[model samples]
Target: MSPLNALNWRYAVKQFANTTLHPQQLEPLLEAIRLSPGAFGLQPYRLLLISNPELRSNLLLHSMGQNKVTKASHLLVFAAVQQIDEAFVADHIECMTQQRGGTAEEYQGLEAHLNGYFRNMSDQEKVRWADQQVFLALGNCLTSAALLGIDSCPMTGFNPEGYDQVLGLAEQGLRSVATCALGERHAEDAAADLPKVRLPAQVLTRVLV
Candidate 1:
């Protein structure tokens, strides 16, 4: 399907069917999220593709009674880094060197710039910035899932501290910012029949120039 058609057909699936995605369908969606853009390409987050039933059940407890947390075939947890420091900048610089076939010394200038930019932000600002990056990946997941004819429900109604504790995110210096449930929609899902409510294009967009 074309992107617009896929989007038109997609909705936040309220009920998932008892169907699992074939690896062929799931892989490409994962690739789209992996390739999602971020500030400075630091990708200050980790995407947790969870299929473990026990873990999902535990997460449901923290999800503010959202059954989709466990009802879906898979759960995607977007965990943002708790902090961005000199070490984080250094790691990105080394990755750039290894991937681009250059010496770390050659990227010292870039590294310094990144470090300086992040240093200006307060601790709270740093986490807020990371959370924004995670949302970019979440948007990619939703669009890719739709294009692949998979059902998805993106949510942020859960308790973050509970999720962080259950997922051991704090130990990893991460915190759950959002989640997307993925699967096939149930045939009886009334939401599928509802017309999408959106602002008209003219009202939602503009040309400044």
Candidate 2:
């Protein structure tokens, strides 16, 4: 099917099959997030791949007892760094410059540009910027899953503080921004049988001309 048709078939899956996604199927979905575009090409997010059953059960509690958290074969946690310090930004720019055969002088110039932009922002602004990068990865993962005929649900109902503690996110310098479950649709999931609901193009779109 074409991208548009695949999108039409996609839904926020409420129930997942018991089966896990094969490694072949799962790798592409992870790659999609890795290659996702982000602000200033500074990818500030991390994807936590959770497949342990016991951990999933604990996560369900933190996610307000959402069954999908446990039922889905894979739980992808999208996390962002709590702060974008100068050291972090400088490191990323230096790595990219080296990969492209650029000199220290060139990289320092780029790093200085990014440092100025981040330094001028307040703490809240910095957090928001980092969070936005996580969202971009989430969007790419969702779209890529849909295109691959994988069932998924984008979720944000979890207790952030509880999750951070359970996952030891503070040590990693990361905080949970969003989550998504990936698996096949359950055979008896009624929601999957229903037609997708969406606004008509005319209502959702506008033309300047």
TM-score of each: 0.97, 0.96
Could you say which candidate leads in lDDT? 1
> Lowest summed-lDDT stretch of 10 residues in model 1?
18-27
TM-score of model 1 (CA atoms)? 0.97
Question: In order, what lDDT does every prediction score?
Answer: 0.92, 0.88
* Model 1 lDDT on a 0 to 1 scale: 0.92
Please write out the lDDT profile of model 2 over residues 133-184, one tens digit for every residue. 8888898888999999888999999998888888899899999989999999
Candidate 1 local lDDT, 87-121, one digit each (tens): 98898888888889889889989998998999899
C-alpha root-mean-square deviation, each candidate: 1.0, 1.2
Query: What is the RMSD of candidate 1?
Result: 1.0
